[model samples]
Target: MYDQATIGARLRMLRKWRKLSLVELADLAGMSKSYLSMAERGERALDRRSYIAALADALQVSETELVGGPHLTKDPVQAAPHATIPQIRTALIANTLTAPLADQARPLPELLADMDRLDHSKYKFREAGRLLPAIIDELHVHAADPADEAEHRLALECLIEAFQMATFTTKDLGYGDLAHIAAMRAGEAAAILGDPINRGKADSLRIHTMPATTWRVRLTAAEQAVERLQPHVKDDTGVHVLGMLTLAASMAATVAADASRARHWLDHAAELAGRTADAPGDNWGAFSTTNVNVWRISLAVEQGEGGGVLELARNVEERRLAERRGRHTAFLTDVGRGLARDPRARERAVEWLHRAENVAPHKFRNDAKARETVGVLLQQVRSTTAGRVLRGMAARMGLPH
Candidate 1:
């Protein structure tokens, strides 16, 4: 039997050790203090996905630790080669293949091959959302027997992947509520599985770490994740990848105007990236100098560093044009163009954004950041030529006259 109070106590202990007040932790985790307190006191259980994720984030621990304590040992049970679990795994693989992409016209076989090449494991653990519910149901049926720990673990891993996918994609698509829900579910599954990596990835998906925030808060969260992951990260490659993520987080803080923290994370990311490059093979999600340079350019843009903007914009544009695949490529190219601040650059950016709007109209309309970017561009370039271009684009997009 699971001890609810023990789990709560462990959570409380982790929070205290991190030296965080309930309110401070809640803010960091993007949760409510009352809900956190309730969970700590064992007065209320976490129901919503965001609340559970918030708890995991605040503790700087994985979902597995919160859900399954040390007491729940893995049972020794082996299944036959064609067992129920194996069948379920097959179904999962199929489901993943058939999963829809941003562009539905693409054939499933072609998309699946592309997905295989992209290395989903490096991106997100699970591919949760509309796709995995059926598989989860089947797994639940198989998990009826108490001795099915292996199957349970497999199920949990799939669920984790689903949530991870949802969390990352939703945030990218600007669906905060959906992302939160997915992240919360991912955390819950991680707790059940007792895996710190799952929890770490889930926490990393939290919206608080998004580049939309002010520099101070973003920097703190990035630092906290790095500190927590450092001991567990074994090699230089792991360190570099983690540093890149931390730097991205810190970049968000810089955009929010936290210069000191931004510099700290930037320096750390640079150091780790250098060390990784010097050491060995392509480990930890292709930590190349190209990616590092992209991060540097992105950081400089966020800081509004005028001198570096033109060079960085030129590099990103060339690279983006060279690798002209994926739904995001156009928008990324437009983002690069936006950094140029030249009249021709602004014109190109507006044109690219217009094309992006056509390809994914709902995406541009729904995304707060995309809308905000449009607004910012309008304010930045008040010239009559820019105004005429903006008006034409707005008219074409069917915006209010």
Candidate 2:
């Protein structure tokens, strides 16, 4: 390691510069003092990009400053171990950081088509990750185009959709800062749209990409978003947005460990669902009966109702959900979690989770709930064949060793 700009040395200097002891820094970083010391001394390298970013955040400095600038790349996706995500890194860096050139803009129709493709599952995790940066970049151009006001409004709305997908894909791939960037862009587009439903949609997405916020804060934000769109319930667009917001609220309530409140929010979402004719899987396509069923399985797993999760999973129309990779991943992972609760069924649990990993390794890898689910499943088994397989699968997905 270099002397002045080595990550460890920088960490030490920054801590001292900030008047923080090792204990204080460790507490802020959510790491043990010994580990923090090792990192500060460069004995144990802070190898992962996520850890570096988190440490930089804890130190109240830019990642560039934390690493002393130009010495190392801060994006984990650019690091050696994550060869799979490098393509996304390339896509993200290919365009302007803040704006897209008007001349480089993709056609307005093309932008909407990309959003539809993404919503319909034509673009899976890998495809979407590669495409989203370009889509967002082009939308950036459209958002600021000084064309007709009507066309300008539509462009802004499309920009919001593009940014939403970008946030989801990047966040799922564990690029937290990139996700926040997309989310802020989405919020900016929402303000340009100046519509109630569009505004609420942006707030709902913050539940996922808002950094370091508690589930309570997220849940409140979601509920407020839903309420904001409630007046427009007669509008199909508003109904669709509310469906998503309420579902987000339900998920956050689950995180808050309030099963009753979670179910209450979900039931409200179902009421909204009934008002809609069908799963308009393009706009709010992720908010349908199938999505709700999938969510029930997830919340049940989190709330310790394994039986309920299994029963809900059975009711989920698998074929109907096949086109929606994200929800389907959640459904299957929760099934694995529920089965892992039973000793006799724990082996099957590993199989189900393994299936999820095979289908969408990136999404499973970065999902906190999915990680916790697999971690719980790992603890439920011993040196049986299934236990060994679970360990192997977890290792492949980069679960904690």
TM-score of each: 0.53, 0.72
How many clashes in candidate 1? 16
Counting clashing residue pairs in each candidate, in order, gives 16, 1
> For candidate 1, lDDT tens digit of each residue in 1-401?
22223234556777898898988888887767887785676443332223444566667665545543212112111101112323333333333212311122223234334433433322121222233344334433333332356755755665555455445445444344545666666666667776545555555555343423233455566667677677776666456547656766666656555677777777777677666652212334234444555566556644444333556545443332222122233334335334434544665556655655554443343333233345435544566765676665444323322
Q: Which stretches of candidate 2 lie over 4 Å from their true place?
A: 1-103, 121-123, 211-213, 257-259, 277-285, 372-385, 399-401
* Candidate 1 off by > 4 Å: 1-148, 207-215, 235-241, 274-288, 305-308, 315-337, 340-345, 351-366, 375-398
User: For residues 312-383, could you state the per-residue lDDT of candidate 2 as single tens digits?
Assistant: 778788777667667677678778767766667777778888887666565665554455455555555786
Give the CA lDDT, 0 to 100, for residue 70 in model 2: 17
| Candidate 2 local Cα displacement, residue 242, angstroms | 0.3
**Worst 10-residue stretch by lDDT in candidate 1?**
73-82
Which pairs of residues collide in candidate 2? 281-285
| lDDT, candidates in the order shown | 0.48, 0.66
- Residue 238, model 2: lDDT of 78
lDDT (0-100) at residue 344 of candidate 2?
73
